[model samples]
Target: MYFFLSHLSVCDILISTNVTPKTLQVLLTGRHLLSFSSCHTQLYFFGAFTGTECCLLSVMSYDRYLAICDPLHYSFIMKRHLPQFLATLCWLVGFFVSMIIESFVVALDYCGPNVIDHFFCDLTRLLELSCSDTKMTDICVTIIVSIIGIFQVVFVIVTYICIFTSILQISSITGRQKIFSTCSSHLAVVSTYYGTLIALYVAPSSGHFQTLNKVLSLLNTIITPLLNPIIYSLRNKEIRSAFSKNVLRRLKR
Candidate 1:
């Protein structure tokens, strides 16, 4: 789990690093600029990391399901090489899909209307600004995002249902609570991340919802990454204990 978590941390860092600095610059200086290549580069990495994280979260849910649902076989199933393979698969799929989508975006001709409404070079905004016909590109992106998002969400939901069934089988209330606690943080992160993601990408975009889209994008790009570590750490007893000790020491000073 920690191994998967470390990779999650890397994804969060890459995502925030991809989007935040330029956003901060825009906020601080009231201006932002990017060359043609730079913007597309950011867009590619953003899509890659986000896609990877979606796969990772689904993977993690499967991990928890095994741990909770089948303890005896858990170690055997999640062998040393298995986690690595899964992580690698996530990374590869993410990059490959992003490459395909980015190709679609790049193929479009952006003749004018250079200003993007939102903070960064988002896929939808790029499509909106293109002078070329974007119907096909839009349809392709929509299909890709729908498959990725819906599949992951459904997989997580199914795994958790099984996990919950296993937990309920435990006669003790304490056992049930303890088991649920182990995954509640993951559930929280998944809900927040996917809720905003689907809302932003899968839902139909419009002038009426441009501002809402930006807000949702902010949550997905910035806030969710910031929250992942905090959410996980808060679930750790040792971390919480040390945090309390540090707060007390600082208070004494």
Candidate 2:
């Protein structure tokens, strides 16, 4: 689990690095000027990372389900090489999807009004910028989200249901509580991350809900990524202990 989590931390940091600084700059400087290439570049990386994190979170949920529900076979099932394979799969899935979609996205020209309402170059916002009809690109993204994104979310839900059932089977209240505590933080994080994403993609986007879309995008792009590391590490005793040993010690000096 920690193996998957460390990768998630790295993913979170990468996404945040890609979006946060530029987003803050735009927000603070009140300068929304961004070249077409630069905008799509950010959009690609952001899309890739978002997809990667979706897969990673589902992978994490699988890890937790195995850890809690099948403790006896956990080590055998989640072998050493398995984590590496899963993490790589997550990255590959995300990047490949984005590369395909963004190639199409960039092909479409932006010859008109470029004032993006959202903070960053989001996929949906980018679709709005195209001078030509974006029906194909929009269909592609909607299909990807409907299939891949929804599948990940559903997988997480199924895993947690199994995990919860297993926890309920535990005779000791303390054991059940301990197991619940271990997963509850992750569950909360997953809920927030996936919930916002579902709302963004599943709902029909229009001028009427433009403000709502921006707010949800803000949560997904900036706030959620920032919250992830803090949520996981702060709630985790091992991580907190290590932080105290290394970072806190350095700061104290």
Candidate 3:
């Protein structure tokens, strides 16, 4: 799980780095300006990292399913190299998917009025700026989201259903409680991450909530990364102990 967590951390870092610096620049300078290449570059990395993180969350759920449902063989199933292979595959798939979408975006003709309404470059906002036909671009995004996003969300749900069934079989109350506790954090993170995303992209609404959508996008890009470490790691005993020893102790001095 730590192996997967490390990769998830990397995704969050990439996402925050991709979006926040430019957002900060816009705020501090009061200039909401981005060059064409820079906007596209940001768009690509944002898509890539978000997609990778989606896959990673599903993979982590699968990891937990194996660990809880088949503890005895969990080590054998995960193996020494399987985690690395899975992580690498997630990265490659994300980049490939993002590249496809980026290509479609690049093909669109942005004749004039290239103002992006959002703080950073977003696929939807970018699509709105294009003068050419966006039907193809819209179709590509729908396909990708249906395949990668919805599929992964369903996969996690099914995996957890199996996990819950296995948990219920444990005779000891303490055993069931302990196992549920392990899953609760993952469920929280998944809910928050995917919930914000679904609200922003998948929900059907009008242009009236563009401002609200921007807030949701901020929650997705900025607040989610900020919450991840606290949700996943800080509550960990070893991490808390280390923080106390290293950080708190230094502050005391």
Candidate 4:
């Protein structure tokens, strides 16, 4: 229980921490906080954290794949130490990659009309606001999105395919049903998460798509955190049992 809470807290911090500085800056500047250096910093962290999340979700999906498809070798394959190592590597890579992209964005100066259209700091929105020659920034963003976002989506799809294929190979109908039940919750989450993510980042960023992008971003950002615990408690037998046990114990006390 303590371990789960600790991890949940970390996720909360990672997702919400970035909002504070930007909010402060906006309040101070009366909603026009797009200075050259500030814009660069915002874009850098935004890209980094966004990329980190994509990598983290892919890693989590892979963990589920190992747990379900190859339970016998799961521990050996993804021991505690390996997860920590992988997570650190993901953060480092995400930071450096985002930094490079932000550098490209900062190289182009804004001439006028620096009003960013989006609520939060995003690369494409920032580029759209730029009155300077933004072709370089656009190209860099396209490459990064293709490599990080699209690549992770493809990897997740492949992982699910493998997981479903393994489940189908089970001979007994009951056994197949059991396996599907274990994975269905994760599949739901992965589909919603990756689906919204692809729509937000991979789709063409235009005025027509802005509303859809904001909605999907809200789904991924605010909705997923609330849904995760509910999904786990409702779909996972062990978690449900644990909750019931805790509740009953408290009642008896």
lDDT of each: 0.92, 0.86, 0.89, 0.71
Q: Give the TM-score of candidate 3.
A: 0.92
lDDT of 2: 0.86
Deviation in Å, model 4, residue 148 alpha carbon: 2.2
Task: Provide the lowest-lDDT 10-residue window in model 4.
Answer: 1-10
RMSD vs true structure, all candidates: 1.9, 4.0, 3.1, 4.9
- Candidate 1 lDDT by residue in tens digits, 103-154: 9999999888888777889887888789999999889997998888889999
Top of the candidates by TM-score = 1
TM-score of each: 0.94, 0.89, 0.92, 0.77
Writing each residue's lDDT as its tens digit, candidate 4 over 14-101 gives 6556655565556577675556676666567766766676676677677778877889998798777888776777677778888888
lDDT of 2 at 186: 88
The number of clashing residue pairs in each candidate reads: 0, 0, 0, 0
Best by lDDT: 1
Sort all candidates by TM-score, best to worst. 1, 3, 2, 4
- Candidate 4 TM-score over all chains jointly: 0.77
- 11, model 3: CA deviation in Å? 0.8
- Model 3, which residues run further than 4 Å from truth? 204-206, 238-253
User: Model 2 TM-score?
Assistant: 0.89
> What's the C-alpha lDDT at position 211 in model 3?
81
Models ranked on lDDT: 1, 3, 2, 4
Q: Candidate 1 versus the native: TM-score?
A: 0.94
Clashing pairs in 2: none
